[model samples]
Target: MAAADREFSPASSIALTVGSALLWGVAHLATGRRRIGLTLLGSYALLVATILSMVTLVGSDLLTLAVQPGWLTALTFMLLAIAAAWTVVIVWSYVLVRPDSSHPGRRIATIVAAVLCGLVVVPTVYAARLASVSRDVVTSLFTPSSAPIIADDPWNGRPRVNFLLVGADSAPSRPGVRTDSMTVASVDVATGATTLLGLPRNLQNVPMPPGPARQRFPSGFTGEPPYTPGLLNEVFQYAEDYPEVVPGVRKGYRGPTLLKETVGGILGIRIHHYAMVDMAGFAQIIDAMGGVRITIKDPIVYGKYREGLLPSGTRKLSGEQALWYGRSRTDSDDYVRMGRQKCLLNAVAKQADPMTVLNSFESLANATKRAISTDLPQNLLPAMVELAQKIKDTRIRSLNFVPPLISTAYPDYEFIKRKVEQTLADRPVNKTATAPGSRPQSTPQQSPERPLTLDEACA
Candidate 1:
């Protein structure tokens, strides 16, 4: 039989059918009179238990892969399963073969079992390490962690609303880290009318609550003293100084709460919920989703940044490339970057079809566990999923707070306050305000524009 064919056979049967089985038989006959050692038998049982666990994991993973069928994703699942099996086998074998008071023939059986275990383990471990690292890289680059927040609000007379998700990149390896993306999704329970608002990271001069001032030194300037209160971003730097508040992470803007409060103050609407995720989780989620397809109409090139280069135009983005797409500020200003971020988000939503997502529920669950932090309760998943299922792909709206309507040149603090005021008052938006240098005037033409495809807008 071919090696491949043999490997697929039942493990117990394989042990009995192969050349190794014949060898075992010969050894058994040679030691026929001797009983197996207690230590050896105990070790063998432990080894068996480990093998059983590995088999269970493999079976579970296989079932998961069947639901979510992507070649790369399936391969990753298999590799991890095999590696887990191998690790257990190695530990089992070591325990089984250790020197002990036993008959010489029993000792020989222990040795043989150890050798067999090693045969299965060594290669699996090596392969697993490589696969895991590669998968991690893919995840780190593509997936943005989104924490789901669900709440019933009497104020809005609605059952569900999603928060604008934000995650500060505070990893030491990252420099000049800032809020990478912001998105607000509001859903009406009765009509299921959903509006997704994508806010630019650099909308400038958003209204923030009055707080003590703090300055942010550029990343890696350990000696530079923190700044005092002035802008909202300054508060972020000040928050970092309070170790009790932020904890663990060193590079994040300290004032996430302040930022949230400021956003709420500006929008003039109470934000019912919030979620924060970092770049690492972001990439993982993307990879888990088998990458996202985005049409990039503009020729975007990041001149130089730690995030690296990206050539624009419709392209299939890996995790790393997607990160660059979201974080690219050099090619365009912050407002434009916000648009790109929305585009990426839309692409992710489009790609995450319910059937596909359901099939990869295990992977999605794993990714969610690793990357997301949310106030959303586990019990709400069924309702959320049901709501999401009803959402037609075409009906989803992506909104951006941009120039002509909202200027980036103004401090974000002021801009956000105006935005909140407008939102709370249920005022009509001036779409023409998006045009550069155009004053936002109240007019009948102020209805928001339909979703702009990348071809029309990005180009």
Candidate 2:
């Protein structure tokens, strides 16, 4: 009898069928179904060509596609289509190679083929789900804004773009949000060199920009009765309480918008975008990223009774430990914590590898969506992703407005702005003064006239 028409044992039939299905068309040719085998091969070739064309058009960096919602949505549909085609091929392969009815183990081979089809379906479904989740997160977080746009220049020809990053101490248990940590990440549009301008949360009398907010806090942001000693951190809560004072600002976003304007006014630059993440949910994100390694200079005592302690030295901390490392204030002061916060930020940025992110993406996505809010326009994401890639390799500098540099109690706004300008103009240093891999030995006591790179500040 011809090999193609011969009845094989169930074991042989199963092996040949499943293996050929994986190879896309080899099983059909083995079973005298050359027509179907060739068709599948041709279809697969076309699919590959279409995918290659897409990659060519989208640019070589596939990771950048994740940030583009429109492209991601299309990718989701394509993934489903590919999965469906694979299923059809697998089924066809099974039908072509199933043992004859007289074969005792025919039932077993049929059951195995169904299982193989299911195996093919599983991972593709998971991938499609991940794509869908990514799309939703991007769409929700970066809603299209009615903000004005420049036709020719996406960045409006700005040399640098500033983003206000806020760590908000707010939860359902808390009445209002406090800006626990605020840093302005200023990035050079062309080079991706970054300057992290850290602001003290307790900065008193922060000047408001010229508008309704400025009109209300004309003599600087002193508090209304019962909320005296108004600090910069309370700006958000204050804005929330009196929405009329921030007319034209969106209702749910008045606080962040006001904070943005206030921060911009303080720094003497326009804050292009703002993103805030809840302090309470901060640990979740760190956990999702599989925790972070930080160089702690000294033992930190935290909690109500100094019950918690994080020992010093280079250590990989869990999410909760990292949170306390950056937020603890029992023996540590805010200024010291602020420096730690900068170190923590730098560590997370540098250590979060693409493989880790991809492996923990689902958990990371959920945690991020629940914890963060931003006013960054959706249309800007692709450009932002490109900039981020640049930042990974570029120099990063940090300057915090703390005691000795500028008093939080009574800051010289003009001096601060001049310092900002000088730091921005300062050329990159060729060598770092600190030892390689050394943590910030002392709280960043940056010179009033000199700029401090992040590597030097928190090496």
TM-scores, all candidates, are: 0.51, 0.89
Choose the strongest candidate by lDDT.
2
What's the distance in Å from true for residue 255, model 2?
0.8
lDDT of 2 at 261: 88
What tens-digit string does per-residue lDDT give for candidate 1 at 150-213? 4453224555465657755555664443555666666655555566666655544344444432
Per-residue CA lDDT of model 2 for 309-346, tens digit only, reads 88878989888888888888876689889888888878
State the weakest 10-residue window (summed lDDT) of model 1: 213-222
Q: Evaluate model 2: give its lDDT.
A: 0.81
